[model samples]
Target: MAKALPEFAPLSLKELRSLWKKYRGNEDIERLVLEVQFSRGVINEVDDYFKIIHRTWRQENLGELIAIEKLRLVLVKQHLRQTVLAEIKPAPKGTKPSEPPEPEPALVD
Candidate 1:
């Protein structure tokens, strides 16, 4: 039987821009964005997007990067699927201990 591929909901343009802002200085995320640009043959569009961001200091230019091209959007969503899920996943809900655990007593021979 063929292995089932995981399904990821498509990310909206807004979400992609938000991700760019949230992880702006992360090298890994920046690399992923470049990979998506190359993989989708949208290098020029992505470059122009970066220029706009550089000029205005606005992260929302990331949205414009994929907005003009549907294929770019699809490629970006696929590349960033894992990152998006990780960022938006809820934190585990549990109470913390009131006090730190005491260090184990030192063993003496």
Candidate 2:
């Protein structure tokens, strides 16, 4: 871990998107990394509650990490597929969700 992100529950989509856009250098591996972190965090937090996992705290292969990485590709693929298939609803009447930000007035020549 180069730098750790703050511990966040029900992770914020806005923060994740910001991280994904700026911090995630490799778009190809973005989802894979997120899925792994999410999966591993869940397992660790659960074990933390039980207090019976990773006694030595070694960085060797753990079952959860292995399983998450193994399934990551498929999960990412599914996520992408679902997003692509999602419906696009226009902003409600009188609402401005779809509107672009108004441009600044042109400077005088």
Model 2 agreement with the true structure over 7-94: per-residue lDDT tens digits: 4344334444555666557866577547744653454344333322233323454435554444555544434432333221222345
C-alpha TM-score for every candidate? 0.30, 0.23
Q: Model-by-model lDDT, in order? A: 0.46, 0.42
Best by TM-score, which number?
1
The model with the greatest lDDT is 1
Residue range 46-108, candidate 1, lDDT tens digits: 434544444453445544434445644654564455336434331133512232223222211
List runs of model 2 lying over 4 Å from the truth.
Answer: 1-28, 52-109
Error of 1 at 25 (Å): 1.2
Clashing pairs in 2: none
Off by over 4 Å in 1: 1-4, 37-109
